[model samples]
Target: MLKVQEIRELIKLVDQSNIEEFVYEHEGSKVEMKKKAGIAVPVAVSPSVQPVVQEVVHMEQKPVQTAALQTETKQEPAAAEAEQIDTSNLHQVVSPMVGTFYQSPSPETDAYVKQGSKVTKDSILCIVEAMKLFNEIEAEVEGEIVEILVKDGQLVEYGQPLFLVKPE
Candidate 1:
């Protein structure tokens, strides 16, 4: 089995290279990666892996283009709404790694922080679980929690905003 750091390094290498697909197998572990729409998605297959067969079908471009245009039009308002927010005074706390965001230490516990919660630099804000490891995320700045950007148990990408804080 590959270590987490090794997997992260592999991901970085694959992302930087021009290769569209990559596959690695050692012993019983298999790692498959592919680029789709310029995004690198990595999949780790277990020891007992089964080959997947996919069928490709040809489609007309005109209807797809029209649908894409309509989707873009519908998303314009959300962009406009986001532009109206004053983010100058807020500090974004971003995820340090790709993981599942957990608002509390456990399911039965209260959240570490919520809107209006005051925090110091050493305060624990949440936990980000990656590869069965629970990493405690801290409030790196002294501030009040302004917003929680993700929901509990949501998968988060590296450098993605997890919280907005109004710094004191």
Candidate 2:
């Protein structure tokens, strides 16, 4: 609910103050901050995605403490990157919204893309049904489908990874 600058300012203020814990909730949005080792860090929660944590480290040499703001996301992208096999530079296509995952255009139709299938930039990988609408999910990169992250009819959350592709 707050702007990035406002959030940054809040983190800075919390870092500088003696307040051990700070919690702010407004209109279903919440922010939690804690004082850790004389530095203030924020722990953010989102209903659809993973938790995002930002760490602020203040140094006395800096007057504005702008340099203290650094994001250390709890859902580490590095760890995800490490999990991918190094043989190919795999790219993950994630669900853009909360929906039911579907492998084919329809039950009788063949799957748009399957494991080991080559896909071009415009290839339709699958469909995601959200609010009774079927949204065609297209491949943004040319690749081979190494893995399918969700099964047909599976409910997927926003940002949930759906496919792993080895780029051609």
Candidate 3:
């Protein structure tokens, strides 16, 4: 069993991590935490899963299985179009948080970045709205936008590949 303060700290860790869910149990007491809009939401304890404190790590990211992401019109994972893009020379910039993806700052504004657009490490490539806060997603690596794997206003999952970039 864990104390309230310990659980709270754990919640903060999970909320800030790339992992989606966490679980901790000792004897009879159990606690679960899942990220929901930069806040840790406690989940009702269930007997099925086993994890002391599940932090959402990027290693566990799986492209959400959805037809919208599997289309042939330039909206699939690099693996789906590997032969066409030559991913060996590209690196992916993924979503750091789960939220609504917005390509442009506003409906009337131009997109922050587009295909063939050059980007620096600090470029604001997109915005992710979570918990009513518009967080700017930046390009951590300099590159040219090779492909956008998602559409505007789509519900993006944590660690979802947002753009495939070819190193400059």
Candidate 4:
């Protein structure tokens, strides 16, 4: 199991290195860490990688079948639309942590935003649930969501691209 100091050091490393990914094993469980792919991923508290904390983030599941279907169908039109935009200067939105990322608040709800959606810094684009906490991930720049790189609830690695945003 990781110690408190270890966790803190890990967080420091993530920030200092601009590295987007990290992980740890504790008691019979393994937790992965990642910064938001495009923007830094948010942790509830400044992530310090505290050892033996009550929280652990697991990111090892496949996307729900339904969510995959939704991505496939919805992404086609979005991709078509995105193709029309110039992408040479697009910025990316990355995963913050190793957890289940939900495009919407819940499965039955519409997504918080979609491709072509205009967003600015602080605009929440999605939720990454870690250790039962739903952390809202916000956009850090003004841009258009040109592409979504990860499907809802898919296991995302640290620094994995969640969305590709084309800055205006």
Candidate 5:
């Protein structure tokens, strides 16, 4: 059986990862974890104890509530329209993994790249911190950065576009 602290550590690992589901079994003990809408919930089962289920039922109902609220307020479409950008001709610099996006190396340093900055294929653009490791993201294509898609210190997903660049 896993200790309470171990289980908590596992939960924290799962929550920080890109994994959708994880399962572990040892000597007839089973622990399963699933992530829904970026929320990680763990379920543990053992032969001697009843299965424990923790479900986020409210998260499942949020879409329905949001739809009703959108119709009632009639504001979502306008907000969406205002946030739209033309990306058809831009080259996207995408995050290679799920992590916290940092615009600069540190708090006092300037960002590696900014809008209107010229970059080569090997130019470092930003850093994505995952599991306490800072992975420097590069501009994989030679271009001029047209826009920064995400703000500093934002949580980003794998393959999420980070910048729009006009290829040189």
Candidate 6:
């Protein structure tokens, strides 16, 4: 059985970040959550507890709510801060082997990060599928993805510029 404490923790996690949805299901228990315009609605389904359903009531508070949420996110922590990237001279992270460079782990999934995505030194920029093996390509430097030089599922050559990053 899922407890109220667990639900509260989930709500706290949602409040602390830009994540829009949280869903978890295990052993006949399911919890689904959605946050629209800074209001979170959580629904939990478990065998032993009665269901709690809440209707989404959109009020005439869009501008105020969005601004408040934005302020809160900025004040909490700078998770999405754009690093000071020197774009005048862009650095290129080249592929080490000949393979198909995938922007994502799977075809049906979204890219690991989009252009203008800030990355740390150890962030995986993309994946290279070669000889039936999928090898992850890591960013050699901390920067923002200035340009994607290769398309998804495109065959990339050795030492090719899979992406161009502007270093911080």
How many clashes does the backbone of model 6 have? 0
Per model, how many backbone clashes are there?
0, 0, 6, 20, 0, 0
Candidate lDDT (C-alpha), each: 0.74, 0.71, 0.72, 0.66, 0.74, 0.69
Off by over 4 Å in 3: 1-83
Q: For candidate 2, what is the lDDT?
A: 0.71
TM-score for each prediction?
0.63, 0.50, 0.54, 0.50, 0.60, 0.48
lDDT ranking of the models = 5, 1, 3, 2, 6, 4
lDDT of 2 by residue, 22-97 (tens): 9877667687877766666665644421222332222232433344243223445555764665635688999987
Estimate candidate 4's alpha-carbon lDDT, on a 0 to 1 scale.
0.66
lDDT score, candidate 6: 0.69
lDDT of 3 by residue, 13-37 (tens): 5665789888777677677777665
Which digits, one per residue and each the tens of the lDDT, describe model 6 over residues 1-168?
A: 555535544454564458888886756778777786665556454554323222121222244467668956664222233234444588889998876789998878889989899998899989987656789999889988887766798867678777778888
- At residue 125, candidate 1 shows an lDDT of 92
lDDT of 3 at 6: 50
Best by TM-score: 1
Model 2 alpha-carbon miss at residue 117, Å? 0.4
User: Per-residue alpha-carbon lDDT of model 4 for 1-168, expressed as tens digits?
Assistant: 555434444544454465677665556545465665432232443334433443322221223345558867775765687578566788878888766689999999999889889998889999987556788989888988878766888655457678888777
| Model 2, total clashes | 0
Q: After superposition, how far is residue 167 of candidate 5 from its true place, in Å?
A: 0.3
